[model samples]
Target chain A: MLEINHLRKTFGRLVAVDDVSFTLQRGQLLGLLGPNGAGKTTTVSMIAGIATPDSGHVLIAGRALSGDTDPAKRRIGLVPQDLALYEELTARDNLRFFGALYNLAGGALDRAIGAALELVELADRRNDRVKDFSGGMKRRLNLAAGLLHDPDILLLDEPTVGVDPQSRNAIFDNLEVLKGRGKALLYTTHYMEEAERLADRIVVIDHGRVIADDTLAGLQSRVAAAGSPPANLEAVFLTLTGRSLRD
Target chain B: MPLRPLTAMVRKDLQLFFTDRRAVIMSFAVPIAIASFFGSIFSGPRGNAKPATIAVIVVDQDESTISQAVVAGLEQDRNLKVSRTAVDDARERVRRGRTSAAILIPKGFGDAAGLAFFSGQEKPALDVLFDPSHSMEVAMVRGILTAHVMQAVSAEMFGGRRGGELVDQTLAGLDSTSMPEDRRKLLRDLLGSVQTFYRQPDRSAGGTGLRGGLTMPYTVREEAMTAGTNVAYNGYAHSFAGMGIQFLLFAMANLGIEMLLERQRGLWKRLRSAPVSRLSLLAGKTVSGTIISLMTLSVSFGFAMIVFGVRIQGSLIGFLAVSTACALMAATFGLLVAAVGRTPASARGVTTLAVLMMVMLGGAWVPTFIFPAWLQQATLVVPARWAVDGLDAMTWRGIGVRGAIAPTLVLLGFAALFAGIASMRFRWEEA
Candidate 1:
């Protein structure tokens, strides 16, 4: 549902994202697998329309996204890498604010907020200020904030960076449910196991360029074709980029 | 722009600001406390309050009628709080700063001073001891002493029983001196005239037949200048205006820092990802900042009005115009700070310095009339000056809505300038 074509972004002398191309289809969870500073977040930022690419463009639902306030932007939801929730506000208020940003209001906004909170299992603590919540709870609330409008494509950028295993599993379950509802998601992460479990197809990026893009079996076949024994996503990454995924 | 998103953003900011109790208190309470403090100092005592008096200790070594009359004259003067004490006690009191000064009348001062006045011989000096720290009061005390001594010595010479003896003694001393003929003759004529005045019938003691005893030829009529409306000057009005302007700037600076923090914390990215325009975001922040500043100024001035009788004596519309414009200017200034500073810490420090300089130059701590001519003219560039002066005009100055036009226009001009610069330099994302 989201298409990024030949996206190139540069910051002065450094190239953050170069000639990056990807397509996130309906009911597909495309894991953008890369190490730190491998342009994972930069690619996600370009697709989400927060940062403009120096060349190329992003298309949402087969329509090119135009300027800052284009209606096409409404089809995409962004769960930023950091917990972007307002700490001073209650969880419900935070959701309401984000909902209002997407033009959601009244009973419809209320129902959407309730559904998102229930999916994240934070319905009971919705009245509590986000600052008073645990780290894992805050991460869940952050995810709920992006889901308030039920966009066609959800961009999850390292959403589980500092989450506990329980919260991580919960987030993975929520993403699976979203995928079942035919919501296309572009999830970026450095954790190979998270990508291995959630992503239907994986795109391995190294140094601002995609080196491998295939399913688990297809990627293993490519590794075997290259004279290396297929082990797991890590071995696949090590063979494809000549470096460990963590490195 | 769609109002829903902009409304949401402004509501969220105001919610966050109000939820932080310390921030809310800082926005409102600090200005009121400071304004009340300054008001009490600037507002002198009200109706029927006793006027301030200087304390004086009188040490009379001469128990003569002339010395007693001088002490009585000082006692009758309403400007001095007089007390009789021994020379040692008076000296100690003055040295310890208990009294403003001490007057020591020497022995035989009445006779010696009477003889010197007529014969032009050596003059008897009255010793004045004063506290070193209160040197300024010494001049005033000396002037009062001179007036009292002149009246007492002259009245005693003209009407007292010692007059005949002193005149006969002065005449006897004049014959033995080798003086210039014309000068001696003038001195003889003056003494002879004094003797003739003493011999006149129906001359009352302690009375020169003047309307008031020891009065100046004419008295000065004091009037306070206002905005041609005869409205009384209210110190609380000026204090509230000054403190309101100063603290409103502080509130806006804080809001700017909060905006910077939002950008640093990744909230800006989330906000931009939504279908909201950049203008909506900036407008939301500006609206919230302006609302907060207006509330702060209102509470401060409201407190002044209720407790201190400060009134908006001019056109009410004029006061509101200036107030609204100043608040908008302060809000835009916050945006400017956020756009210019690279980080929250740096922005806070620089904005604080700028705000303090503006407050000082704008005469928030003191009246602008007390500022030097060049400084007063130079401070016109600071927007706070217009805000403060505008409020003053609407309050004690009692000028109408016409007086508010220039200040309101100037403040709006500053707001536009700040908004333009901030929008040009604003970074939507961190570098």
Candidate 2:
């Protein structure tokens, strides 16, 4: 449902995202695992059409995202790392606003807002201003806002950052529901456990390149054959991308 | 195209605006407070049109009839209150600003006039010493002295001539045979007219004992549409309204900065991810800013009316048209600032400086009339000036609806031009 080919982005002297490539099919949850400054955000931002790449292309539903940018944007949803909800507006009002941006209105818009809020378990608190909400609650609302238009592809950029354990689990559970409903998701995170548990296919990225691309079990098998402790995704990740300060 | 999102954005902005109580007070209450305070000061004591109080010190060195008459004249003027003092005290009063002017009558024993009449010499002068810094007071004192001197000289001449006898002697002098009949007849007519004028009682003489003539050398008659209403075209009011309009435009910049923040926070990304077009998002922000500006302007004018007793003598529709255009221009200006600025701080710095400069040049703090001729000519480019002039022409100057139409059109032109530039330059996301 989504395709990227040899994506390259450079900022003056530095190559932020270099020779990156990946693909995701329907009902599949793909995990893009990388450390800080691994160009995970730059890659995701390119897919979301927020940033333009210097070379290569992105395709959503067989339509080139770089060529037909607006159509590609319409099919994709982005849940950013930060809770980008308007603090002044109520949750329902925020949902309504975003829903309308997708040209949803009247009864249809109202129902879409209601359903999105319900899915995030924030339906009861929909009338409360986001400024009054807790950090976890705000994150949930942010996810709900992206889901309001029910796009085919969802791009989540570290959605669990700063969230409590309970809220983190809730977000994982919600992703499971989306997978069950045949939705394709591009999830980026540094948490190996999260990737191993949720990703149907894992793409371990380091220094803007896909170093390892396979199922969690297959990636672990490679590490075990190399005299590792029947390594989990974490040991494999550490083995492939050495532990060093990235700042 | 998307009513729902636009409405939602506007609602969100209003919610935030109201939540920040300080912003609310600054936007609405501050203008009213300033207007009320300034209005009271300009309206004068108890709203009565009394002259501003000025002190006058009298140095009665002569202690003669004419000097006493001058002292009495100053006291009776109502605009000036005279305080009797010694010469030293009078000089101290003038120096200390306790008195605006000091009248020093020389001790001539009422002999200066007699000497001037008999010996043909200049009279002993009344020296009116005043603070040069108080030019208005100095001018007033000079006028009063001139009138007193004229009165004393006229009375002395009339007393010496005894009216009819002097006229008869003048006619006899003109009776020489060398004089042409027509010339003698013209002289006789002139004398007869002079005698008649002297015989008639002076209309201004009964109440004050001394007649007051025109004090100011030149008269400036303000020709306005309204004939009867003595509505002075207060440059201050025009300036206040101009500044008010410009500042209101600056408030719209805050709205635009908020829009940029929304985009950075992924609100725009999410909205774009929906079936909405980028155009719709931009439109929503622009509309919201315009609406807020218009509402602010309405509230400000309402406050102006209630506090300053300002009236709009032209068509209400015309006034609204100009206001709507100005609001649109302001909103467009905000969009341009947001498009150029990468962050809220940058936007604020640029907008604040830009708006203040515009207000100053647009004659918001000072009337364009007071500006240098070249500067006044230069203000034509300022949109704020057009807005202010449109309001003044429609309301204070009583120029009617027809007179405001051209200015309203100019404002609309600015709105269109600014909106076009902003739309062309605006970007939804940071590079």
Candidate 3:
């Protein structure tokens, strides 16, 4: 379980994340949908313990991780938007390195690596350097690296952005399995279909503020009440955040 | 914080450093190549195949026979190159670094009142125009001039014609001062002994008696300050000390660039997100850099001992202590640079220039004794100076722990200062 309470972040005169708040229980997935420069990554970054919140709190089952580095950070696994794998190292070595940072060792570490690689469908190619792998294969390996530590919660930002359709579907199936295992997941994406299929609930953000947050039916009803009857999360998101170019 | 993750962090970094051929070449290979280059350049004793000749511009205003003879004597010396020039031109030449010194023999130098040997008057002074920055060169020029003066004074007092002139002049000027009876008698007897000594006849077939000329002007007696040492002022000791420490700092700063790149590449962000403390991350890089520098210095000094004939003249333990301290200073220095520069490209540029200046000011290429007084004092702030001095002491100077204490403590103090700056400024993530 994770909690982001009134989290806000600013870069000079610009507010990147303003009073954004959310909570995710075990076995639930929360899709954070936003256009470019809409603070989706900033809010997720705070939850992943990667960036400091200018104000408010990021708590792991009510334990704060805001003071630079704290032990509560071990409970969260971050799959950043960028591929964070070491290009020179094999996929297996990358997993071992990140796993060691979480204090995982011996057979438990090996088993975790094996399971993560298998789940990502890259277990057969685990010994190959990440640089030599395809974009989709590297994405799989990147996801597998974060899963090596078996964290209580996972914060994945655009996890399938550059992956092929098959790899994207594979990532979808893997998230399903992780949700079934009762792990809290925060998934951020620009793809409406992926969020529609994977997320149980969606929170739409724009310009550093959460404009709408509800279950699929609840959001559609809100959009319907706003003059036009919206059919899906795509119409709900566009109608609420506006159709103008965000940039 | 536990050491496990910190150790893992260091191991991962070292693995990356070794696997990257470019890093390997920059860190270890380049230093080896440079060491061999310096070794060959300084292959001979005193670092050159032939001794450098000191430039002497003589301003001979007194063109008497005695003054011309002194100028000729300076030309005949092996270590000096003599040329005649005006006083202003010679002074300008020395000022412009074209010459080491200028010898000014004023007017009336060879007259009876000017360094008048027979009359027992005060010796006239020859002004030496020299660059104060060129300490070794100035000392050599002064020493050569002093030797020349001693020889000329000896030659005048015991030579054929000058010897007779001295006795006549001394006996003639005896009553000019109106001294006490005892003092006058003492001076007369002393002059009488000299006259009798020069009047003696030459017995050998090839002998030149006192009036002919004194044959050997000066003789040297050599001794070692530290007896039974493996080296004695050869270029190898200075070579290893200079180039070894110089490249070690360079390699250390380059290692710090790796840490800076980590911040740019987002690896530092990922590491910070881990359960580990930020101190552990900083410590990991510091430890890794220190280890690399130590291994680099050890291999360098080891090869220098076998190939360049550099020895550990003092306690090996003391040498180890100084080496370790310097390695620590280099580690902290790299961290401080990474913190200050904050980016890979900027860190590389700033650290390279900084380390180069530190090595130059550290007296690595040139001996500290040869540096100007102010420069020598200013270079005390550079930790590499302590390292070079400490290594030289343990290798050639042979003073042992007592000599190592100062350098060791100073290096540790520098390490602390660099570490303090790093802790205050090191950033976990780019803004």
User: Over all chains combined, what TM-score does candidate 3 have?
Assistant: 0.79
B1-431: candidate 3 lDDT, tens digit per residue: 77778888778777776777876676666766776776667554442335567888999998865566678788988889889989889989999989888999888675543226544566677899987778788898887776665555555566535446756677777878567778878878877887777666752233555543444655776455541533455456666777778777877787778777766666665677788877887898888888888887888788777876777888898999998998899888888888888578888888788888888888777778878899899989888889989988888777778888899899999999998998888765422
TM-score of chain B of 2: 0.71
What ranges in model 3 sit over 4 Å off? A11-13, A65-71, A163-166, A224-235, A243-247, B40-230, B429-431
Q: Against the true structure, what is model 3's DockQ?
A: 0.44
Docking class of 1: medium
lDDT accuracy of residue B247 in candidate 3? 75
Candidate achieving the largest lDDT: 1
Ranking by lDDT: 1, 3, 2
Clashing pairs in 2: A101-B276, A102-B275, A102-B276
Please provide, for model 2 over B1-431, each residue's C-alpha lDDT reduced to its tens digit, 9 standing for 90 to 100.
64665676666667677776776676677755664554545444332346676788888888765556567767787677778889998888788877789988889724565334322346577778888789877888787767765555444334323323444555565665365688768757876775665565663244332123223446567343341265654433554466468667767777778667876776655554454455666676677777777877778788777656677766677788778878887877777776777888778888888888887888766567868899989989998888888877766676767877887788778877776777777774322
Per-candidate RMSD vs. true structure? Answer: 4.2, 6.8, 5.7
Candidate 1's displacement at residue B202, Å, is 5.7
For each candidate, give the TM-score of chain B.
Answer: 0.81, 0.71, 0.71
State the displacement of the C-alpha of residue B125, model 3, in Å, after optimal TM-score superposition.
Answer: 16
Model 1 segments beyond 4 Å from truth?
A62-64, A216-229, A238-247, B54-215, B226-232
Sorted on DockQ, highest at the top, how do the candidates line up?
A: 1, 3, 2
Residue-level lDDT tens digits of model 3 in A1-247: 7888898999899999999988888999999999999998888777776677889988898888756556778778888787887888888888888888888888988999999999999889888888899988888887887788888898888999888998899899999999999999999999999998999888988999988888888888886856665678888888898899867
Best by DockQ: 1
> Better model by lDDT, 2 or 3?
3
